[model samples]
Target chain A: MQIRDLVRRRTPLGWKQLVHSKGRMAIATAGVAFAVLLIFMQLGFMNMLFESAVMIHRQLNADIVLVSSTSRDFASPGTFPRSRLLQAVGVPGVADAEALYVTPRDWIKQSETNRGERAQMLMIGVRPDFAAFRDPEIAAQLPLLVETGTALFDRKTRGNFIPFRQAIERGERPQTELGGRTVTLVGTMQIGSSFGSEGVLIVSDQTFFEFALNRVPSAPSVGLVNVAPDHDAAGVAAAIRARFGTYDDTMVMTMEDFIEHSKGRMRRDSAISFVFTFGTIIGMIVGVVIVLEILSADVHDHLAEYATFKAMGFSNRALLGVVFEQSLILSVAGFVPGLLVSLGLYAVVRSALTMPIAMTVERLVLVFGLAVTMCALSGALAMRRVRKADPADVF
Target chain B: MELSRLSHWYGAGETRRQVLFELDLVIPRGEVVFLMGPSGCGKTTILTLVGGLRSVQQGSVRVAGRELAGANEARLIANRRQCGFIFQAHNLHRSLTARENVRMGLEAQGRGLPPDADERSERMLAVVGLADHANKFQHQLSGGQRQRVAIARALVAEPPLILADEPTAALDRQTGHDVVALLRRVARERGMTVLMVTHDNRVLDFADRLLEMEDGRIVAARPGAAAAAPVNP
Candidate 1:
């Protein structure tokens, strides 16, 4: 048989029924697309939230970290004595240790009316010689931080920092006040902002002590440690924790454990879990309902035709194939437009919210698979009417 | 085909009203028989039984050598593949064109597609005088043309038997007569047996034999008046 005829023979009549109604098909496709958009957006936001929560930890330049035993998370990590870092360096398998200070400083920006708006800015402080940040852009600018009264600014920080960014890009210094201290923005980097901190600044430990209002000089927020080449990082972290457990007031952990601790804390404190997980379920339910209504109506409209086929010896399986074909067509047709629209939406949300909304291949495949399952389940449920079509009754 | 003491009912226990009363009938192969009856006379019930569309409640119904009295859906589907059924409503799928509807009949046979299935479907459409309208959907066709498409669908697979329930009920007198004449020519040309139920008296002349039904039993059987006359080729 010719390929055309062979294909036509296998194609069920439901496909024709779906395409024949131009208005209904468009409406059905739009409904499915809306549901898909909901799911994609929710998943994108959730992923961005998680990535942002671990942004600093992921870029940390140390294998093991020390924190205050009472520290909740990186956002509000309590300070520990700098002596703990010195003590950690004395342990075996310890290459070196550094003190890193993190605190949210008040950033003041002057608007057109000469009125200043104050925003909280997260500031990280490390020694000039042992640069702690891992980003190539920031690492390249480490020497600039060593200069007195200068700090590197995060270009991705939220709010109206575009003027300052443009000024720095033009190779001119734009000064901003941090905790009432006159600090010049010497360079810009791509470290992202987070929910807890609206913007970020990188300064030397001495500059941080100068910019931060009530920070003690002997204490640091976190302690960074590098394991010796032949030593296991986790083993050294355990050794430090064991040696410090009795007297010292520091929490010792490998970098990965620190990241997980922050992530676990965020999951417990934030509403991200409820919004994304529940949102996806709601989207699927909406899709199934819309598809069920449309497919059921299509089946009802073609009851006589289905009965005729049944009378002509079509099995229930063959007849059900028609419904399934319609559903698959709807899924594929709707998903392409939904994906295209969501790309535009992701761009809008990322720009507007300064969040890391991205379209990964894994998310794309996941949402498409979900769309198909939603439509398939609807088709299966709508087959009830097809089963009731008795050939004798139609005659 | 044969039916001996076959009966059927519609409802449960007290509400059950038997539609067919011990119907005993036999139709020979290659004969075109028309069943004439008023509404509620059980013409359709017996036709459904013979076509394996309904279960035989009592006695036996054998079509093409298979007993259908206790047959399951698979058996019924297998038996149905051997027969072509045409209905009063010209129940063509509205989404499909005239040619596609005819192709469904051949597809129902479950044998893999024959090389000429599409061409054969077109040829059958041409035979029913719908060759030019093969691509036209059901709603786009007139009443006569729709019935012609239904006829093309019924005969496309060249089954051994054809069962038609009020095949031309929706057409006018001339369309009705033309439809029956087309059916008679095709049945004779293919040597296919046909059992048709109709209330229209104008097409009675095309039947090789006629049986009159009343209240669930056959009241009269005689040679069709047209059997003695030459049927138009």
Candidate 2:
């Protein structure tokens, strides 16, 4: 039958039934909205967790990257020889390669009011002329790092640094000790913090060796390679990989792959992702239970009316359609408030964690899809009760 | 409509108890028949079987030339579309208005609504003296008015057969008489067959034929008060 004809045969039975009891409708809508809100928050946290893990890798200004084969992730990346970067520069479409030294150090926050408190911070050492960072603000301030014993602090760091950041904004160079050596904060960069480190400190390559007393200068943590214009980074990366075969200690990959690798490691090693996914499933289950309760009660209330419909020659499928329609209405009515509240909560979480968590179109569609599926499943289960309506009993 | 040696039972195995015992009856077109009996005499069971609400377990039931003895669910549903049913409780959907409740009868046939379905429903309501209460929900209407609405709903689709079970059981004396008189007049005007089961003696004059039952058997058959007198008398 044509859809219009099918619709014409229906008398808005589901809508009439729902609106007949205003209080029940409100309760059902609220219940579904609560479940949808829970699912959205869990999904949001899960995506942000992975995003924060690769925040630094995404900010690096390089077409290709080289790391030690033994490196697991950013938190514990092993070092590779500096000679590999020099060898990489000789490849056909290769631009200049820069060495980046990374190490975690304790910063002694020695303020007059608070006795020396220790905070673990990430330290990145780079060349003053060729700092491999994508942000223009950080690149412009790289000249300040040319002086030894000078560092640029990350402005988006996660701990309590209000006084230290205020001092930098006031144009007063703040003095802090890193790994027991005194250093001055010359400027501030805007690389946000990740789960591995609460803050980042950028220093000159000479100062990096001075502060990292156990590390040698000949080895670097990562090699950043830029491709010459009009050449493909993937091709250069393939050549670099061929140069450093399985026997070599270095691993070559495009910058995009490097970021994905970091995220993959985080996903495989962290239990937080599994927790968030479980939370989403739990939300869906709660939604199913709520919808089932509402629908079952509705069917029980109107059992005689449903039997009368059956006695009047209405098929079982048509009767089931009425219940399904109610479910779909609840899903749509509830999703709007859930999405609105989730957006508000997302803003709060982003500000509190300094993480890159925002509502995307894909996530919105995904959560809405999930909500519909949850309600539909409840509708299917409630149909069993509808099928039990016996026309014989109505007489 | 015809029923030949139809038997029905409730429950299974050792708990089984017979309700209808090889009953035989035939109703012609455009006739209004009443089946009257005390409680548990199987009057309502006969009405249910003829209406295709219950399966005929022992014998044959033919309504509108279709056999309903061993019909499947789909066939039974199709047979039900040819008949209208009125229950003891009126059974009006509280969510729908009087006119909308009447319109449901036409929609139940699985055909899209006719272009003039509203006019038909309103006209049916007017015939039953309920035109003014078309927009009122079931709760807003009195007991007698709800029964009239049920009658309108049963007749709006113009089915060939109607089966009513104590349609006036809940109404007052005058209301019950009026309801049956209206049903009789409409059945005669439309040439529709009706089989009603009732214990109310006040409405017996509206029937053309009356069958009295006892112990699942038809004990007597006679002309009702509305029938013409015998020539020899």
Candidate 3:
């Protein structure tokens, strides 16, 4: 049969039944919407966690990155020999290689408003001439780091640094104590904060050795390699891995793989990912139960009517169509409000925490698919009651 | 319609009790027959069996040239489509209007709604003197009007037979008489056979034949008051 003819012939019995009682429809819609909202929130937070963890990796200028094999994540910066970077430059397709020294150090806030307030911040030391960041604004400020005691500050840092930031904004160099030595903040970079580090400070390699007393100059935390034009970064990374195959002290990977590895580590080692995933499953369960209750009650309320339909020659499958239609209607009706509310909540969280949380088309489609599946499951369970309607009972 | 040696029981082996004894009866086409008896005399059981609402346990129930004995669920449903049914209370769906309720009769034939179902339902409602109340819900209609709508629904599909159980039992005296008269007129006009079960004596005169039952057996059968003079068909 043609689609139009089929639709014209079928009575919208489910719609009429649902709209018969306005109060019940409203309650049912609200119940489904609440569950949808819960699922959206959990999924949104989980994506944000992964996005925040890889914010810095996405901004790095290197096509390939080399890290210590013992390093678990950005927080655990196990050092390797600086000579590894020198050796990497001799390999085919290697354009340039640079050494990056990273460590967490106590920064004594030296603003008149909050003097001597110490905060732990990540410090990155690099050669002044090397392009260390993909952000052009940070790259432009690299030349200022050529002077000793000069450093760049991350403006998106998490803690209270309003006074220090304002001082830099006014073009006045603000002096802050790092490792008990005063350093001048010459510029600001916009690399946002993550769960691992609340703030970042960048200085030249010469000043890095003066502040890090326990570290040797020959050992750097990371090796950055830029592939020459027309050379694939993955191939170069593979060659680097082959060159260091027997050496267990360092690991090499393409930048894309490095970002994924970081995200995978967070997902595997952090309880937050599990908590959010569990919450999402719980939301789906709650949705199924609520829809089942609504549909079961609707069937119970109209059992006699269903029996009358049976007596009139309706088959069990025909009766089930009515219920499944109701479930589809509820899923669509509830999903709209749930999605709108979630968007607003995502905005609130994005601004409040400076976190990389935003809506994507994939997430929207996934959640909608989940909502439909949840309602369909409930419809199947509720159909058991509809099949019990006996035609003879109507008499 | 014919019923031969029909017998039925309720419950399992331990608590079994016979409800219908071995009975024999035949209802010719276009005849309006009423089955009357005291309570617990199998009046409704006969209607259920003849309507294909219940399985015929023992003996044969043949309606519209189809045997219902040992019929599968699908076959029984097909048989039901050829018949109409009315209940004691006007079991109209409250969610639908009078016209929509009537249309359900045609829609329930295991086919989708017919293309001209609206006009057919409206015409059927007009036949039953309910044209003005076609758009009104069951709750909006009075008790007599609801019963009339039920009659419209039962006959809208133009079934070959109609089986009603206490169709006018919930209506008042005058309303009950008008409803039965309407039913008789419509059934006669359509050349449809009807088997109604009722205890109301006021509406008994509309039937062409009356079968009186006692203890699951037909005690007496005779022509009704209307049998001698046929109504204008």
Q: Give the number of the best model, judged by DockQ.
A: 3
Cα lDDT tens digits, model 1, A184-229, are: 9888987788888876788888888888768876888988899999
For the second chain, the TM-scores of the candidates in order are: 0.95, 0.96, 0.98
Using DockQ, rank the candidates from best to worst.
3, 2, 1
Q: Determine the iRMS, in angstroms, of model 2.
A: 1.4
TM-score of 2: 0.95
Label model 2 with its docking quality class. Answer: medium
- The residue ranges of model 3 lying beyond 4 angstroms of the native Cα positions read A106-119, A175-183, B231-233
Which tens-of-lDDT digit does each residue in B12-82 have in candidate 3?
98999898999999999999999999999999999889888899999999998899999999998998888
Residue range B1-233, candidate 2, lDDT tens digits: 99999898989999998988888999999888999999999998888788778888998999999999899989999988899898999999999999999999998988757767889999999999888999999999999899989989999999999999999999999989988888888888898999999999999998889999998989999988876633122
**TM-score of each model, paired residue for residue:** 0.89, 0.95, 0.94
Per-model CA lDDT versus the true structure: 0.86, 0.88, 0.88
DockQ of 1: 0.58
**Model 3 lDDT per residue over A6-107, tens place:** 886878888888999777777778877888899999988898888887787788889999898876666566899877778788899999999888888888
Candidates 1 and 3 compared by TM-score, better number: 3
Question: Between candidates 1 and 2, which one is better according to lDDT?
Answer: 2
Candidates 1 onward: DockQ, in order: 0.58, 0.73, 0.82
